[model samples]
Target chain A: MGEFEIFGMPVSLGTMIFQAVIFTALIWILKQKFLSKLVGAMESRRESIDNQLNLAETYKHEAEEELLKQREMTEKATQEAKQIIAKAREEANIIVKAARKEAFTIRTEAYENERRALKGRGAS
Target chain B: MHATRPLVQIFGLTFDLSIIITSTIAALVVLVFAYACTRHITAKKPGKMQNLLEWVIEFVQNIMVNSMGRKDNLFILAGGVGLILYLFIANIMGVPFSFIAGADHATWWKSPTADAHVTMTLAIMMIVYTHFIHIRLHGLKNYFLSFFKPFKALFAINILEQFCTTLTLGLRLFGNIYAGEVMLGILAAAAMKGFQSGIFIGIGSSMLAAIPMMIWQVFCLFIGAIQAYIFVTLFMVYIGQRVNEATT
Candidate 1:
């Protein structure tokens, strides 16, 4: 109490201590009811804001991933279709070439036969 | 002429009932501002009360964070808006409770802050709490040893600074409030003779009394708020200096 009294006042140290003790009690009570609640609300608000931001970021990334996947699938399907079409075109070319060759040979042979028959008839 | 009559007998000590009564009123005013306004506070949708509460919290939080970083959340919360409200109410108590109910001027219901005991108590508490915070931030051994600092010569000065802080903080507030209230009392005393008569001289004296009292009351508002801010900010700053690595 002596240490607490500094520059000395009209009132007793006991009275000052009593007042301070009352004030401390009030501080504790106010802490429980007021300060803690407001701080909690602020903290909760900050956390919710962070959560919303993170959620938005995740949604954006997920959307980009979905877009990339769709593009890859479409690209793969286009390449497969092109490969099939090219293979079918090559097969058609081979078949058409063989058919043309066979027709030409048959025509040539018939022409030759017809010429030979004409020659025979003329010779006869 | 300073005197207080006992309003009630509490234990063996004679209590100054006016201080209790006036202080109770001030405390209630603060309580309403603190709790009633902030009741049903929300994180998302804030009402006007919440807005005010948030503003005050942000203001105090900014001061605390500027001193010590955000890591000291416990300290911040503990030294938050409550102290400001209490001290502001305490400081301005002279305005609301200036009326003397009794025959004698000795027994008036002015602010408890006008009383040195109350202010000194708060100062002593500040001293105790400042040391407590220093120890809490830096352990006991380190806090005690740090008083020696770069050299042993500063040891006495460091110890004396704590006492000086308590005295200065307490007396500064007490002096301001006590002096202000005393001046108001003088004004009131001067005006008593004016209203007693119906003459032109009385009217002139009454006008003289009216101007200073009104002006001082308005000024009282500013002084009260500024003193409260200074007191709380100084406490935080002192603690900050103690806990700060640079100051140590």
Candidate 2:
């Protein structure tokens, strides 16, 4: 095998240079065409994910607000139920008191009439 | 043999015939598959090949986005495509030759990355590209000064780091693939010698030794692909770091 010399050195500088040029071109093409699109697509995807996350957060907030409203409605219903029950109890108490008073008056009037009739019978 | 030689000659340097043939064939096959998948792609549903191609593309895209932080770097796709094409062919290089399975010369079908010269060239390209990006982002003065620190010792350390990055990038890929080829060769030789020595090894016993080697080879193939990926990814990270620092 015969060695070829270049610049007083027995090195395949030409091959190395050729390879280097090819490599550079490949990288340049890659960077210019492929990477630019990839980065754009990636940025768009990230934005989409962020939008989705924001929407999810808004949904979560809405759900929490609905839950709080429901809780307040339940509390209001419970308080109203307690008030209605209390009012019904008060009305029942008043009705019982009036009936007892009317019953006592009727009994007293009947007793008075009976006593008067007995006195009349004894005199005659 | 003479007729089969000199398939690739540039500037009086000759590369083996089979390497160029096998690499070209593999590249063409991959390109055809990509084209076929793209042609048949649909919005409603994807075929098997389309789905597979999409998975690879999306995987590489995700890695690029995650590593580079969604910079407008279209080069990642080119890097990714080159990586996949190179790595798949490299892994399959030894599969065709049944008779010369374990011989050193059997590697006439060289995985381009398995060769130190090839890997070094790629690594140098990445280094130069990253530096170009750095200079574009920071200008020559800032880029050059970035290698130095206020403290002289730290400046020296920064220089060392740069050197190490290039060295590691080349050596890591070269070491992994070369070791894998060597391992496969050894295993094949052992199996062949065992068969020839009238050992009368049972099929089960033979499989016991062979199965692990086969599994390991598959694992090595995956590792090789990942190493290529890591190299490109690190290159992006280096560029990103420089860009972010300059902007800040």
Candidate 3:
């Protein structure tokens, strides 16, 4: 009546099961009320910190890349502008030289006509 | 003194309420301690109580991680903190207060963990949980087939191993806590005997008996903690074995 024998082992299954059920309730309450909440809060805090660190790192790398790209683009633009300006100045100089040569040719042709006219008059 | 004294009847079920009452008090003590220690926990500027709570939580977490390699889910779901706290508190329950109260004062309140019924229940639960995990993870076929692995000769040994889990775990905790409590009881009896004797001899003898009794109480602290740790360690080990691919 006190304790029963099961498989040659004396045990109070009722008490054992009762205790188990009691502890199960205890763990459930503790988990729901305290342990789970605390652990979750700690995990979230850690995850948030990790996320912020990652965001900061990504932003830093992106900013550095943007700065490098802009510097390269500025250099490229300056080189191209200088080359265009130099080429334009050279073309203007060539135009000025051609105009001077054309004027010289016209002037020489007029002088020849005048000389020829004077020669013809003197000869006549 | 009888440990299983009938306390009260609720409905039709008569019960031995010593373990229940002691366990409830132990549970409440742990609950209050936890609540007080962690109620004002802050992410920044944590107090000593918070630090202690964090340390205990992390310690249990580390045990799980180390034993189960951080992959298994049971390591997370089965909180070792409560088990350790409960067992440890129950193991030391006799240190602060324990008395024999009955019609003849033959019924006693010792450590709840000292009770075989309570320890067996905890052990059975752990083993059941481990077996459930093993079966779920490895599949029922594999779980059963695992007993006969490395040739079919290991079948009986494997069965015994399963039975032994609850037996050993429960008996070990019960034996240790019970022994310690019994020793304290002996010391208390000695002190009482000496204190109750004739005049001059009583005072001197009682003082002498009280000395060892106090010393043993101090020693019981270490024993309680070590027993709790061993219980937790064995539990995690069992879980680890079950979850792993190896049947043994």
Candidate 4:
């Protein structure tokens, strides 16, 4: 015989069909059990990555807020420094004016006293 | 010469040794390269091999999203990758040694896809899986209604479309690859016949003809890969449509 026959059917045909069935079964099992687990792992990995992205986003927002706060603080500090400088200038100006007025008064009193003493000596 | 026998039999099944060896070596090379590429994957910056692999992954992803939409059927992405890898390896099985690899073999296990049994099995799986997805997504009532047309006269046409989709998917791949193998075999036979006459003339002609055939084979390899991709993409689209209809 060319090949074994079963019920006048060639064994090769039966073998091919059997192999196909087995292969199909193998793929089905892989898809059901193994592939499901693989998909679960993939999904978990995706979730982790997404969670990291969210954390990064939160960090970015916090950084932006911190930067804004720093800017506002710097601006406030600069404004305070300007006000203090202006106040100090005003105080220095007041002190200098008072000292100049006192000096003028002292010089005038000394001149008057000297004139008075000269007049008494001349009389003597 | 027995030691250099071309055929090997296992479990009453015969296979061409040259084809088996060549395909195994090719598969090993691809597997090793794929593993090596996987090891170097980094989110920051990717090397050349990593970039190439990522590009392929993204390309397949694009195809999946386009065909299936970016919804619940993302699981099909893995299937698409498997299809592409298997088809690519099987297509390039005949590349080395002047297309004298699995394509030239005349036994089981030669070009795993060239065999009708293998292709039909894949087709059956895809078709059955699609139907299973459909039934699972949409209960039996709506899924069966997909076959019924607006008019009763068109019911047969609608049913025919489903059958044709499965039939064409299997036949198209088989037809393309089988024809390619046949062409390569004919060319190899002609070259051999010419070689028997004289070395100088035979070598010159065969080399001249081989250059174009080699180029064509390369093109065929790409076509084979594309056909495989198209098949799976269509399968995903079918499933996606069913899921969409069910949701709506």
Between candidates 1 and 4, name the one with more favorable lDDT: 1
- Please report, as a residue range, the 10-residue window in candidate 1 chain B with the lowest summed lDDT: B1-10
List per-prediction Cα lDDT, in the order shown: 0.75, 0.63, 0.78, 0.63
Q: Tell me the lDDT of model 1 at B22.
A: 67
lDDT of model 4 at position B239: 65
Tens-digit lDDT string for candidate 4 (B1-248):
00122454556664445444544454455455556655644554457876665565567678767866773343565565555665566655654433333443433333545544445556767777788888887778877886764667788998888788777777777777767766765666667777888998789769867977787788778777877777767767776676677555
Candidate 1 on A21-96: residue-level lDDT in tens? 6677677766777777877888899999999999999999999999999999999999999999999999999999
Query: Compared with the true structure, what per-residue lDDT tens digits does model 3 show for residues B171-213?
Result: 9999988888888877767766765777776677778877888
How are the candidates ranked when ordered by DockQ, highest leading?
A: 1, 3, 2, 4
Q: What fraction of correct interface contacts does each candidate retain?
A: 0.44, 0.17, 0.26, 0.03
TM-score of chain A for the candidates in order shown? 0.44, 0.53, 0.46, 0.50
What is the Cα-based lDDT of residue B204 in candidate 2?
41
Top-lDDT structure, candidate number: 3
Output the worst ten-in-a-row residue range by lDDT, candidate 4 chain B. B1-10
lDDT at residue B180 of model 3 (Cα atoms): 85
lDDT of 2 by residue, B1-248 (tens): 01112234555775444444454555556555656656554543457865676676676667667766763445556666555555566655653222232323344455555555456666777677778888887789987788765565688888888788887887788788767766666666666666776667544446665887878678776877677677767766776676676655
Clashing pairs in 4: none
- Model 3: residue A16 alpha-carbon error in angstroms: 1.8
Error of 3 at A67 (Å): 17
B-chain TM-score, every candidate? 0.88, 0.77, 0.89, 0.76
**Candidate 2 on A4-116: residue-level lDDT in tens?**
56456343333344445544554455455444444444456668778989999999999999999999999999999999999999999999999999999999999999999
**How many residue pairs of model 1 clash at the backbone?**
0
